[model samples]
Target chain A: MLEQGKIDSRQAILLIISLVLPTAILTVPAITVKHAAQDAWISIIVATMAGLLIARLVTDLSLRFPGKTLFEYAEEILGRVPGKVVGFLYIWWFLHANALIMDEYASFLCSAHMPDTPVIVFFILGIAVAACAVRNGLEVLSRFNQLFLPLFLGLLLVVFILATKDMKVTRLLPVFDKGAIAILKGAATPASWLGEIVIFTMIIPFLNKPKEAYRVAALATLFTSFYLLVSILVAIMIFGPNVTGHWIFPTYNAVRVVSIANFLERMESIAVAVWMFGGFAKVGVFYYAAVLGSAQWLGLKDYRPLVAPVGVILVALAALCENIVELLDFLATAWPPYALSVFEVGMPLVLLIVALARGKGGEGT
Target chain B: MKKIAVLLLILLLTGLTGGCWSRRELTEVAIVLGTGVDWMEDGRIRLTVQIARPGAFTAGSEAGARGREPASWVVSAEGRTIQEAERYLAMKVPREIYWGHCIILVLGEEMARKGTGMITNFFQRDRQPRENIWVMVTRGEAKDFLETYSSLEKTSAQAAGFLERMKTGYSVQLWKLAEMLASKGIQPAVTAVEVKEAGITPEPDREKKSPPQKQVGLAGVAVFKEDKLIGWLDPYETRGLLWLKGEAMKGVIIVPSPGEPDKAVSIRIRRGSTKILPEYDGEYLRFMVRIRVEGDMVEQQSREDLAKPEKIKTLESEMADELKKRATAALEKAQNEYGVDIFGFGDAFHRKYKKEWRDLKDRWDEEFSRAEVNIAVEAQIREIGLLTKRAGVPEE
Candidate 1:
């Protein structure tokens, strides 16, 4: 057991929010716009709702095992072999998700700020920072989120305010131009980000108030959805659907135009600040979850010793994708509603149904 | 002992990853302030760059001591692709080229006429080019335009950027042009830069005599048919287009006084707003453009005391008529001559009638040419600057 430090409801909310918001806010606008066009904001709302539903499902399952994570409780619900298989799947998902996040952070920094720097540098440095936070345990990571999320949000709002000068309200018009089917198609990618809240299963055992976990997760999803909506709206209004759909990072591009008498310009540096720290807190949460969950599955007495090895593997996995275009293709077409939904929503849902059918209850624990 | 070991390990790691890998010092990089693209007669694209010499910016420096070479070095190279041309130019330059600071992109008339879509790919593909860099079309070779220098600004690029900031016409940034070209509902319009010998002859002065100077100024607006430049709109017509697009921040409109036949009153526009309403009569479509303009009378060459309530009202009506004439000329040219919807009327239609816009979107330019447009101008004279009546003319 890694120092049984407990976090309150607010920290849970911050942790989940930090985990899901950073990469989605930076990349979802372009992906959603590709399918939904002017109605991308509608897709975001639909995805947020789907995400909240998934969160509710995961919270319900975690509540069934008050003090046990998904790894511990899966075997209790299923037999040993099948349960280990499920545990391995969850471990693989967390590792994959962390690697993907690391890849995104590294590529965005490489392309946007320092083009000449090898992307491996970012992967190594990012994992190093994340490993340090993960070694400090869950409480430290939660405090990191609690401290930096507000600054991230504040700088985001400043960018939003400065971007209003170029925004055209009519750019968002012609709602439902591509019809309901297209909007739902656009919702898939963001829905994956929201469903990743299922990672909370590992953290719920450490929550001071596990009963309030569902409400906290819902609120976190709501806040993330609201920020996603604002980002997509600002991008669409400033750059329009045609540009936002094509540009790799439309929100950063919108912030790049925040030139007010030259003194208030280059606000992209502030955006970089948000991306760096928010991305750090984000990867740290996943890193903690992956390491802790793996240690628990392997029946280790402590999870801290597993952090560095797993962090190294994650850094290596991040380097597996050679270029940004390949990563983006995976994100747009392969990840959503497929690999992501299967682990993030499907597996947990299957566990819930089997547990209910088998008459397994948490009161005896 | 454990803490000391951990501290030492951290120090070793820091030394290993102290600085950003692939970092280039400022002295080793040449900053490109502006870029110009022209179509060569040999069927290749010529890329011209205005490289800012940082040393010249220092006072009394070798390059700036006698203004031997302004603050920029202009160079051009020709190749099939813009990147290829840039790579060719890179060989002749001494330092690595940095494009993040480039603020302006000038397209030559021939290159723009041939279609700017081909040359703009590198700019969009590379992350270095800022989306908000000023995009303009020059009347002649873009290389020649980049060579024109003025005494006001340190370099020609700075002068060009300052001239654009004056709001002579609508300023189209690279990304906005991209957006316009990509979207079917709207077309692109860029400011046109013209380099000519200074019209005013130099007077004898104590300073060392300088040769006749070449000045660069914004000529008008370059209207595009899809991605290709089709024609130009005169200054008044450009104002009309800006007014319709709600970008006419400040400009002057000279109208002959209603009471005095020969005397002209110049009204300095202070504020303006435009609203385009698409009216569908269930059978045919008609567009109504309502323009509201507020200005102050800057010059009244007549002795008529135009600040009087009745006189101001008459002037306002006359100004309104003049505005309508200008807007109608712009509308007619767009509708009849070029047959392009540069005023974004198609977007207005899209916002108003979403379902119907889908049907007409494909052939919007054709429909726009035959569509009925109604122009209504509401001009208000809010203030008469400094004087209530005429200044030099005898007040009768």
Candidate 2:
């Protein structure tokens, strides 16, 4: 085994959430709200279901080749050359997803809190920290996430709760006004965010009890969708339909508006803290996967040597968006069907079907 | 030791790269307390800001050293838009301008009339002054409001902010303003303000009272059509607008006493809720508004045995009628005069008739103007003062 560390089922669940949640709350609300209007939350529910189905497909396939990562199973099921091509796509997807996570966190920080700071500073600091975690391997990443992700989520919940005074339930009125098409379109945008659960394929082989992969998928989906739902729903309730669609970061803006007791204001500082931890955890997960997958694809003995060079490449990729507007356009429209859905769900489903058809890796444990 | 090395590396990375890139020292930035926007004669925007003097805010540090210097500095500059004007204004300030502490935004009447769509959108898009700032419309130039020194507070902006906080008037914050501006159903309105004469001040050099020292006063609400200011709603009409909108009603309502026609009765509205029900006939639309209120008798000028059941009933009816009249006046002004639905009737209609709203959404103000509005009120007397009647009046 190239990697020796093991994470229990609960830690697996936590790691999956840490992967999907942080950036999901930031960009998904703005993108989803624009498509679905007031029904963005309904879109979120639909997206959650799609995400769960994808998670299940990926989990079932990874379990069939017990203790084997997606990269290894691709080689077993598709044979060497073709499987390596598929393996390269997963590697690219991991890099692209990590780049996006880093880009969004930096974009938000620059525009919201530190405009004078160049975006690359955040890129360097974020990826540099994440690289160290990647080099230390999965245990360090998941354990750090376990300690930080909960505290981050709690702060977000507090921000929403404090903003309850300003929230008008009527803002969510006239439900289904845009009908099913808009809701589905809205769901499609965040579906990519939720579909990020497919990363569980990488972690399933590392779970101490491999059968617990189903529990991991179910729990991560529940947490990711719940986080997306509350943040998007709270944003719509607080900012209304027309207003919610226009903000680049409606959740952060909604968080900023939380003024309680004349003292609990400017709470976006807490938001910065949450994003920092989230970005670190998110970048950690994807960077680890990318490093680990690349090592396996090349048949390397250890993944640690690839960490620094990959970090440099990831930073360069993170800068490709140019700015938040470009980044958002890519995330909302360009990335979903072509990149996230295909790799996260479509490819996994195809691979699963192929494996079943050929009777490859049949409960080989 | 390994953990320490990793911790040290992480600390050095954040300490060296992330925080320093955007680090701004407190002394390097000018803290703005209020922002003022006025329309120039050429239709350009003249941005004015009130910056608090750090030394003056230290309680007594600048006591006599800066004899007549106000506690804040005011500066103005002009450009085609707020950003351009801000850029010009920044040329004059010695330090980088900061808006985090700016608690108020004043719009000159001219700017409010010409249109505030762009101005509201500016606040909506920007990150600073992030949303607690209360917006107000001044009857005169916003520059004057921002420039005027205050004896009541450290600065005129603080004084005007205090006036809005008094809560006797309709005030909207930046977020609410943005929402209202973006929302199609409800037009926007904000607290109206004006420069007023507070008292005369004697000048040692002139030996005469300086033009009665100016202060900012709360002046009703400035209503709007889309983002253009249409007109003002007086205090009475504002109260009615509040009731029609179903917001919690405050302030006092005075009515003529039932039998004692020569005197007046005062009721302090504690809290109330309103329900706006919309009805559509074959061709026309009708809105039924039900307002339920709870109030206390704060003052009774006529001793008509006010606590008696029949008298209380008469008093309640009179209160209800008075409330209905105010609300009707507000509705008429909104419909017949301005034709702007600031009461959110369009929203109420949409909430009920989601299908019909598709067609009506475009021409809502027209539909709102033509709709028939009927207001119903129910008032309850929650409490009587120390005595069932006036203290001076003979008890039954």
Candidate 3:
């Protein structure tokens, strides 16, 4: 194998955070409000705990087989054919996830601002940007996110301040009104979204400090969950639980209600611009993972050449999603447990069990 | 050489495609000032749009050149569906009607009584119409309501704009409509626009031909269950609903003191909040809504000695009772006659007692009507208007 460059533990953590957190910020709050009501924020906390437990299991498995990617280790532990089958399944998951992310960006833009603009335009633009980022390799992508993440965080804080005048604490009254079942059901979608952090297992062999990768992942999970919690709380406070549940984009609606004065009105356009950056970061990371995984599965020397073609496929698939309602239905109903089984509970558990049974125990590196 | 040529071609293609995708300029489109929906005599929905004549409004000279009325040009069309109506209207208008800037959507009382869902379908489906655009039901024909210009404001649009900004009176927006539609428990309520004869003053000569009459003022609120308008609330009741929803921004309240014919006090609401607590007792679900208000006295009608803490406390208790009376009256009317829970009591109960709400979901209307409700108000008199005592009266 050609010499593979390594990423620092911080870069790995940043990659995971940048990829998993933005989608949660945009979509999770609305979805949680639908089932959990005011306890939507608590649902996010539950999802985060589930995510951290999965991350720990994946990290433990990766540590036992240091310097080797999950794909390579699966072959040694479960034999070549079954491992290859698993690898193929993982690639399908990554590609489908990429399509879904692209769909989210297109739907949000179409609904929020550019009504006349064709959805295909967003698809093409997203794919073009994502393809370029993927072609530059993971290190370049990580560096770009590291530079933009602080701005993203600062923009969120600024929104919180602007919206303080309208925040109603009574909106959060009578917590857990719907019983525990509502919150548990609501946690399903966010937990599956958080499971996307498992992509770190595929990238962990390329980390400079593999020993610290678990801690980094855990920290990233906590930070992303906290950001999601704050977002859910703010959205509920601004729109009230009932209103928050009805709107397609609760955060965008919350920002729309932000009016400091006559001149400060229509501030939601600024949020749309900021969220576009988050969308780009999310798409770039997912596209990069898909490209790398495909190249590895096909035994290619480099992933750069595959980026454009796969990007085209993803853009096409995203546009082909029937409409906004269909897209939402797919994400809410079809995605949760399917994604949870594969990304969270299924693959990580299998790898950990295999590693323990082999008794090689932290010697693969 | 190939790379250079390909790059140039790609750049040219991008510019061409990008230009076509985003060709809408703000100036080229006629911003819809307001929208009115009415049920015609023929039973079809009549949709009217007040399109701002940008050329005429922006340049005062154009208004003179066209010999047209001031403010805006109105376009009317009729169809079974709002989308079809919009398309018909589009054919008659010179420029495309853009709803992005539309601030007010009005429904005639007839149409509101028939159902507002058909008229509101377009606003909900179309992405351009903002979720916060004010929705109102007019007592008269919606077109007439839109056409009535106010003398105090620049135009009827400006008058409607002022009402939206007031935020203290009756107001409901598109997103609130959606929330009401989605909530299993609560019914929707929106502001009502009524046309009052614009204080016609008889000419002194009495022989001159009478000029065209004008109408103005939009007060009261239309309450709806599902999509049908069921009842109406006067201005005071609307203010009561605002308090219940915790949406009261700034409004003056007048309370008459007992045994003093001229001792009515005017209070300016400064801050207020409401909390709904849901508790279940066996088969009965009881709701306790506690309202806390802080206000400063804006006017004192009597010569009662001012600067006394005990007197202020008396005023506070009276104001609190007034608030309770108004809130209870509003709730009773909404629940008993209208059979609508516009105060979001159902949503509150759902959040507070989820499992019990689930059991009571099917019979929420019955439960809502029979459910016990307690209203508690706490009003603090912070300051005594500008003057501590009534003007023109000497201090005791």
Candidate 4:
């Protein structure tokens, strides 16, 4: 093994929370509102169910092969060629996920704060910080998340508390106005966002309580969805469903309303800071997963050598999305059912079934 | 060592590239305190900005002399669009125009009447201008209003902003205007300003200096049909609008005392809130606006020991009647004359009957015009003034 590091279940859950919550707060609400209208919160709840299912598939598969990542266990279950194909697919998924997150981070910061600065600068700043965390390895990455999670959550709480003064409960009226089908359509984007918790497969092998992986994953998904639900609710309450749907980032706009006595106005900078920390962690985890998975697939002795090369490709991929509008269109219209469902759920569930059929690995100690 | 040289080079480079590309030092930037828009005769827009002079407030600066002019400068330029006008302004102004501190936006009557559609794009699209900044319309030229020096505040724009916060009228911030424009049934309402001669004549100056010049004060409200200004509401009507919107906090209301024909009692509104109840009976849509007010009697000219419970009750009823009349007048003008639903009755109706609202949303303005409005005001007189009766009046 190129790296020797162990993270307990608590760290694992925090990693997933940090990975999933920022996207939920920043981008998912607007996308969900566009499809669901006033019922966007319902869409998030439905998506949470789908996310919990994906988490179950991943944890169940990881438990079958103790102390082995998906990269190692794939070959054990399938033949070598097929295993490498699946491994490559996951590598692609990680790179694409990292690119999507980077796009969101860059677009938000550029549009909201630094309009004169190039989007590429934001990408460079983010990936540079994330690259350092990747080079430091998983223990450092988990610890980084553990330290920043409170600040991230604290800022989110403050935004909600300040915005409640302007919130109107009547804006949430006319429930089921669009009916369930529209809400289900809205569920696709957030379901994919929460399904991102399947990144736990890479960290599961290093868990101190590997036996409790299911419980931890379940709790993490529940907590992430809860945070997302409150955020979406507050967003809809502050900017009504009609206005929120039009905004590119509803939660950021909600934070813009955190003015108290004119002295504390324009405090969305705090939200931007929180996102920077959260974005770094998210990109770091995905980048780390990609590097580690590719190294394992290549049968390399160490993954550290691949981190920088892979980081370049990740940044370049992120730069491919021309602008915020194009990225949002891709996220809403294409990315969900195509890439997210296949990798986060399809491949993992298929692997679990094939492993069960072959009667391999699960019977061991 | 080579490493030491690299570190020192980085430190030197850090000094060279100090504050990024967009950084402008305070002295080098023109801080915009207010902005105004006017429709020029040549089919162009006149953009005016009140830029604060940084040296004016700094003690010991030559510009900070007590006898110097006011602490802000008003500049205007005309162009096809506001951005072009601003760029034109950039040509004349020495410092870069910074809009981060701009707290007030004023639209001239021509601009307001022709419509606010063209002028609002700069504020909406620009990242610098905040969304919560107060937006108002001036009775005459916005440029003239921006130039008038306010007696109370250092800058006229600062005075306008403070007036909005003082609850003299409904303050429509940029975001609220955007919200009103986006919503299905409501139209935007902006506070209005007028340049008036200062009521207080400067104490007869020994040197025979010019008397105090004209200053800007809150006039009323500019009511809109969609985004175009259709009419103006006087201060009393603006107060009525505010009462219906639940934004009326502090204002004086004078109502006729119970038995006295000429005398009246002035009540100070401490707090107020409004609730709208809508009833739909398959054909007609009726809205009941319930205004609840709590206030204290500030002046009683009747001198009848009006602090007595029955007198207070009578006073409360009289106050309620006065509020109802004002609210009803504003509502009638909005519904019948302008055919605009400025009070957001449609939103209230939508909240109560969502499905019905969808069917009615297309013809909402017509429906709103036809809908019968009932105004009910319940006022509570919490306390009388320092005295119960006039000093000379005999107690009965």
Candidate 5:
């Protein structure tokens, strides 16, 4: 197996945020608006709380086994065969997740700009760039995220300021118009996205200051939730609940209405560029995790050789995802419970039982 | 080292190509300034495009003529679809047709009456057209409508731009159309333009009489129900509709006394808002509409005393009653005759009572017709005009 490179707590936190937050902000608002109406933002808040609890559990698992990855610890805790099975399943999840992210990025680009260009070209180019980054190891990815994070946050703030002229705060009135159950349903999909932090249990061994891992993860989770909440609120204010639900990308459409004195009109092109940047970062992180997980599972000497082949497989799976409707349906109904079982329920319970039985429980380092 | 050099060469070549996928130079493309859509007798679509003459625009001044038609060109084509018509027009021209700069979309009365769904799909689906472009329906053939040049503006395209800037008139943009289409309980309304032949006095010296002069004016509004144009509202009714919809911008309202000739007051609108409250009274559903307006007095008649509070109160009451009367008449015509709920009553009900709407979703139109509406107008004359009294006021 490839020797793991050490990542500091700060780099790990940035990696998690760069991975999970981008797609969460871009995709959650439109999906939540359809089911939850004006209370969609509330659903995001609830989902964030659930995400925090899952983060705590995953971090606790990491503290139980210091310097050993989840793939290695599972065999020591459970029998070797079952641990291997779980390891293989996690690899499959990462591969599928990366493919879905790639599809989302390519499809969004196709709809917003360059409609005539084949989406496959974007998929191939995006995966190729991501493969190069993954080959450089986690340190390079983390550094790239650190460099671009400020730019991403600045663009978001600019979008908020420019859209203030059209924002109607009254549109958010009559809160909980649908009921509590709708909000709960809306929270389910985003909670799954947030729960992907379980991957941190595997990566925590790489952190230089393993003790500070929980604090960094919590901070990253908090920032991501706040960003997602702002995105939902902006979408609801620009387009009323009825119209927001109908749009595929309500935030993009909301930015399309940003006309500052007529000369600054059609700045949606800039929005498209920013969107692609964030999407690429997200896909890069996920693709790296998938390739690394595959190499670790296969017991290969190096993950570098596996990166290109896995990247091709991920792109093909993304192209096979039928259409937008099927992708959405899969995210809403099937993915959430599957993700909860692996990330939230299964991993945490396994670590808890193993830690109690071993009786060497004061947070291994 | 050899591999690195090969990669560097490939990168340099890629950069040298400039990597512009869909860029067309300004000179190589016919920048569509405006587009007009009309319906033909054989059920085909006729599209007229106003393309700017790039060379003439650069030359600045024509050598031979005084006006010279602003040095622009117009082309018309007919086909089964808007895209097909565009393709046909492209065949007659040497340059690529670009619509990124197109500012206006005009629909003729016949085409609008038949339906605007098909006409709007082209703009919605096309990547070149921006969603902020203004949409209008004309009262006559759209081709003839675009042919009319204005004396004040450089081209008919400039005239169309002026009309779009007149926010006081009934105006709708593409985003608003999309909202109306997506909304469950609302219909779309667009400004209407009409071409009327201007009477021209023959110049004895000129051999070529100016081809029958035409002028464009804002005429009524085209109201659509489920993408089909149901009916229209006259200019006065449109003003009233705008007031009720809280979209009125600086239009003047003239309130004339019943039996007194030349006895009228002109009020200029400053700000306005309309609130629709839906109430269920066990038997009949009723809507309570409250309109609040603030305006300045621009004209006065009958030598009414202005300094007294009671006199101001009387004037305010009279103005409010006049506004209510006009607004009620507009509502009555839309409700009783046309039976189209253009005022977004369904949206109000849906927002206020979501549970009830879920049950009454299918029969919304029926429920809207049966519902009773009460209108109340509150007008405040904040200030008198610069000339408080009429120009020919009697010397008290």
Candidate 6:
């Protein structure tokens, strides 16, 4: 084994949640609303179901090869060169997805907090902290996330609750205005977002109780969808569906709209702080998986040496976004099926079907 | 080794503490309190901003020391666009401009009449302006309202914000404006401000003549037809609009007594709600505006009320009649004259008649103008004051 770490089932669920939710809140509502309009909430629900379906498939594949990662089992299922190619593609996927997450983090901080700060400044600062946590091994990163999720969720709930003052039921009227096809078209963006839950394939090997992955995945999916659902719903109710589509970060704008007796106002900092916590966790998870997966592919004695060089590469990739507009343009148009769903769901399905036909592993757990 | 490591950590922390280029100190920024926009005659935007001077705030708590130099400074600049005007305004000010605490966005009468489409788009598209800031249209120039003095609060912007919170007229914030404008079958109507003379409290002395000062006060609301100011509604018409929109609160309605000609009774509107019952009968559409009001009989000049239920009934009927008249006048103005659906009756009709709305949405203004609206007000006297009759009259 390249690493020795054991995280409980609950911690596993929280880790998966930390992996998906933070960036989902940043841009999903606006992108979904662009296609779905007033029916964006319906699109989000459909996307959640699709996401859970993919999570189930990916979790099933991980269970078929218990106590072993996809990298290890791919070699067993297929021949050496093909398995290595699949493993190498996943490493690239993790790095690419992690870089996008970093890009989202910097874009949000710049617009919501400080607009003039250089993108490289945020890239360096964000990667430095995330890299530190990744080098601490999986258990340390998971435990650190355990301490952060509750605070992040608590602050998030507080903002939404205070934001209820502005909610108008009339804004959500004329339900299903855009019809089913538009709703589905809107669902594509967040559906691809939810598919990121396939990161569990990389983490199942480290779970103390690997058999609980299915139940944990289901629960985490439910928990995460509730947040995403309420986030878009409140944003629509407060800003109206058409207006909600105009904001860059509707969730943060929703938080900024809260005014309780005028004394409790302008709490964008709380939203910013919550996202910062999620950013660090999400970046750490992908960074750790990418580094560890590369070490496994190369048969290295230690994975720590690759962390520094990989962090440098991530900084370079994150800087690829010229500005927030270009970043959102990519997220909205091109990245859905190609950059995200391919490795997260496509190859995993093929690998699972191929293994099922050949009947590889799972004889003696 | 521990001491050496601690020193190294401190050195690194020192080098990394000051944030990136966006970092700033408090004294280096000018806090914007109010923003006013005007349309110049030569097709340009005139931007006026009320910036708070923190140094003048410390002289508060003493009676005579305040208002000597004023607590806020007003400045204006002009350009082809709002952003250009703002850049010019920025060039004139030494400190960095911060809009985190902006209290209001005021549009001048000409600007509102010309169009508020660009202003609405510009404000929401910006990252700094708040969603809760009050949006109002002034009778003359917005710059005057921004510069007008406020006696109750330190600044006119704060005073106008407080006025909106009190629901003086039809209160609309930036978010509400955006929602109304963005949603179909509805239009935006915002509160109004006008510079009026607020006479000094004490009587003017013969020797020392004090100059009359101007104060920004709420003056009903400016009604819009798709972001262009078509007309203005006075306080009573605004109250009627409020009642039609289910927001009537903290207002008073005076009704004539049943039999008496100049004698009347006063009813304080505790709360009210309006329901739009859209009826589509295949050939024609009719809207029944069902308004229910509950009020307190705070003062009465009629002498026929000595603990009598009949009097309350009659008073309720008369109050209902008054409400109907006011709402009918507003309906007449909106439907017949201005021909705009600021009351969101179109939304109710759309919610109920979604199929008909598909064809009617393009020509909703005409449909609204032609549609028959029936106003029915159900007014109830919830409570009477302690006295059943006149306060100081002896039992006769």
DockQ of each: 0.79, 0.78, 0.47, 0.61, 0.43, 0.74
Model 1 stretches astray by more than 4 angstroms: A1-3, A363-365, B1-17, B59-69, B199-209, B281-283, B392-396
Quote the chain B TM-score of every prediction: 0.93, 0.90, 0.88, 0.93, 0.88, 0.93
Docking class of 4: medium
lDDT of 3 by residue, A49-166 (tens): 9989888877887788877766677777788888788878887788788788878878888877777788888889888987887788777788888888878878877887798887
- What value does DockQ give for candidate 1? 0.79
When summed lDDT is taken over every stretch of 10 residues in candidate 1 chain A, the lowest stretch is A356-365
1 against 3, candidate with superior DockQ: 1
Model 5, B50-81: lDDT tens digits are 88877656544544465453545789999999
Off by over 4 Å in 4: A363-365, B1-18, B59-65, B201-209, B394-396
What is the C-alpha lDDT profile of model 3 across B1-396, one tens digit per residue? 999999999999988786565577867787897899999888888888887766655656544665534667777899988878888998998677788778888899999999887777678667777767788888889898888765555467557867876775777778667667766777788888777766544667888746655754657778988889988988878878877876764687788743364678788889998988888865877988999999998876666665588877877888898888888878888878887788888878876676777788777878888888999998998877566566676534
TM-score winner between 2 and 3, please give it. Answer: 2
Ten residues in a row with the worst lDDT in model 5 chain B?
B60-69
Instruction: Tell me which residue pairs clash in candidate 4.
Output: none
lDDT string for model 2 (B35-126, tens) is 99999889789999999888777756646665645689999999999899989998999999988888899999999999888886677677
Return the clash pairs for model 2, or none: none
Instruction: Put down candidate 4 lDDT per residue, A76-155, tens digits, no spaces.
Output: 99979999999999999999989999998888878878878888887887888888988889999999999999889887
- Listed in order, each prediction's TM-score against the native is 0.96, 0.95, 0.89, 0.95, 0.89, 0.96
Q: List the pairs of residues colliding in candidate 6.
A: none
Candidate 2: stretches off by over 4 Å: A363-365, B1-20, B61-69, B199-211
CA error at residue B370 for candidate 5, angstroms: 2.8
Q: Write the per-residue lDDT of candidate 6 for residues A75-146, one digit (tens) a residue.
A: 888879999999999898888888899999888877767778787888898889888988889999999999
What are the runs in model 6 whose C-alpha is more than 4 Å off?
A339-341, A363-365, B2-8, B11-16, B19-21, B59-67, B203-209, B259-261, B281-283
Q: Which stretches of candidate 3 lie over 4 Å from their true place?
A: A1-4, A115-121, A240-243, A312-325, A361-365, B1-20, B56-69, B198-215, B255-263, B275-280, B283-289, B301-314, B371-376, B386-396
Q: Per-residue lDDT tens digits of candidate 1, residues A115-216? A: 777888888888998898889888888888899998998889888998898888889998898899999989999999998898888889899988788789
When 3 and 4 are scored with DockQ, the better candidate is 4
lDDT of 4: 0.86
